[model samples]
Target: MNKKLIICALITFISLPNLADDETTLSGAELINNNCARCHNSRPVREFSISEWRVIMPHMREKAHLTGSEVKAILEFMEIASSPAQPVEVTLAKSLTVNPRDVLTRYGCQGCHQVQGAGGTLGPSLDNVISEKGRAFFLRKVKEPQFNNSSSAMPQMPITDDELEALAEFLSSI
Candidate 1:
């Protein structure tokens, strides 16, 4: 019984660090989703460049009534999300298996754009934007958000081609 108790305690101790990490991650996403939507729609983490975010977060923190630690978590999440995309060599088979909705959530698309009667309102509702705009146009816009409008505020999303295709098709259907 004493040996079992020791092993259990050791296992719990080993898991504590991971539990903290999980809590922080969940809180960061949850804080943004819950708090930001109270007054205005939540912006996507990739909406601003890191430098831009550095300048913007303080003001937003005050406006959003976020604590320092809350802001830190959000900033960390933003920094991770805004980093340049690493090239991923996705095979055709892998691409075929990609879930479009997961891609959208991973990239925080719904933070700015509404889809299927849910999501934020910072950007246009995407329920029919893809169908209204051709798939080629949607693809170009996401790849280079400023392709047509040099002054557009939309950030270039760090997404793979497979993910983009999947998202486009998914959005088009909605």
Candidate 2:
């Protein structure tokens, strides 16, 4: 009876899959692919921080309709499989100027600004303001808002002058 009990216990232990160490947990990449890759490719690992991941995961879960366990698996895979981050060139910040339309797209300027009477009414219509206001007034308003009209809810956009000028030009053209 004692020998049979020992054998049964040994068989059960051998049959069970051993989990990896608690510190360095193994991830299920196939589970991630099946669940995540259905909607969007795995974003570059460098593009997101842990905090960003936490924020984005819920939105992605809604998008992909992923369960809690699936999301955990995917996050684990990302944490374990993350490669060493590449050094971003600091000079790129000084050299690069984002296009005005891209800025508008990124910041959702049209959500408020009415270029040629097409955008939202939250703020003053930007239509013909480029031509009407002239470049100086436009630059000044963009760089330094003289007044935050209590009625108007315009968020100060963080950008450079060249970008502002480009935005002015883009708005005027529209």
Candidate 3:
């Protein structure tokens, strides 16, 4: 009996990782495609954070008539998708074609102020703003332009947190 117990413990220990990896399969993808996509087109899983998803799922659950378990599965998938450690450079590179300048254009940022010789002159040039203000400050400004400065003319950019982070990373590099 002692020998049998030892063998069983070893087998279970060895199989734990395999079980975890198997659990990570595209179950979330299927749930999103079958349930979430019924109402609207599929969205990129990494677009929103887990906390945002927690808030959003309840609203969507009622609309889609999803059960609690379905919401849990979708949240699990998004948590993995938007994990902080996921390399942002891969997505940024794919979109920009290795040119950070495209972010400004894509976000309509070029129409306001010049940064590397493109954009309107209504706002101050961002030649050294990144260096001066730091990335966190820059992100705050982008998210809430008129937060502190009442006279600030910049509009609140309608962008996801992921895009804002990518834009900030690109801006800081420039």
Listed in order, each prediction's TM-score against the native is 0.46, 0.40, 0.42
Model 1 poorest ten-residue lDDT run: 86-95
lDDT of 1 at 157: 79
Q: What TM-score does candidate 3 reach?
A: 0.42
Q: Write the per-residue lDDT of candidate 1 for residues 75-112, one digit (tens) a residue.
A: 77666556655443322344446899899799888898
Clashing pairs in 1: none
By lDDT rank, best first, the candidates go 1, 3, 2
Best candidate (score: TM-score) = 1
Query: Candidate 2 lDDT, tens digit per residue, 58-167?
Result: 78887778778767776766665564443433222322445766877776778977756667887678777768778777777766564535444566678776677678
For model 3, the run of ten residues with the poorest summed lDDT = 86-95
Give the local distance difference test score of model 2.
0.65
- Candidate 1 TM-score over all chains jointly: 0.46
- Quality of model 1 by C-alpha lDDT: 0.77
- The digit string of per-residue lDDT tens for model 3 on 68-117 reads 87777778767766655422222223343334455677778878888877
Comparing 1 and 3 on TM-score, the stronger one: 1
